[model samples]
Target: MSTTRSRYTQTRSSTISDDQIADLIYKLQQLIPDDQIHTTTLHHHKALNTKVLEETCNYVRRLQREVEDLSQRLSELLQSMDNNSPEAAIIRTLLMSP
Candidate 1:
């Protein structure tokens, strides 16, 4: 298993002045139609959902690996018990019981 770190960082600095922001907004209002904005929002939401699904799959796979390891260890412990031991015979009986 391997992990990767994102190198891209969110910008904390805002160089745009208030006047520039107002100008940009005014231009955006003129350029982007109201109907298209809804489509844009939907696209962003789908992208977010994809990321969530990917993360969930990774977690499930890791848990499955841990469960398999625990099962193998349990099997080994049972096999190490002598067949003549009372407790071991009881365990075998329990396992074989219908």
Candidate 2:
């Protein structure tokens, strides 16, 4: 029947989406910096998953911005200093050492 076929298709689509969400959440868990997302009781809730994914994405974006700002500042500092100066040498050495 048409109705039965439609229902089966819908169920298949839903299962696929659920599997995709589970994969995303697993990757996110691995990327999380801390052991804080306990999530033992709330993983089945769609709203909670959305919230967690949003927060994680925002946090990573913020970190990216911070790294960019710091790199720019460091570049400026190096550019403003005399290339042969002791401070520049020390900075270069530190960077190379670690």
Quick one: best lDDT, which candidate?
A: 2
What clash count does candidate 1 reach? 0
Query: Alpha-carbon error at 37 in model 1, in Å?
Result: 11
TM per prediction:
0.45, 0.50
lDDT per residue for candidate 1 within 1-98, as digits (tens), equals 00001100111122334466456545644554546446759667555555665465556556655655554554565667775888766765654577
Candidate 1 regions off by >4 Å?
1-37, 83-98
**Model 2, runs deviating above 4 Å:** 1-44
RMSD of each: 18.3, 19.5
For all candidates, the clash counts are 0, 0
- Of candidate 1, the 10-residue stretch with the lowest lDDT total is 1-10
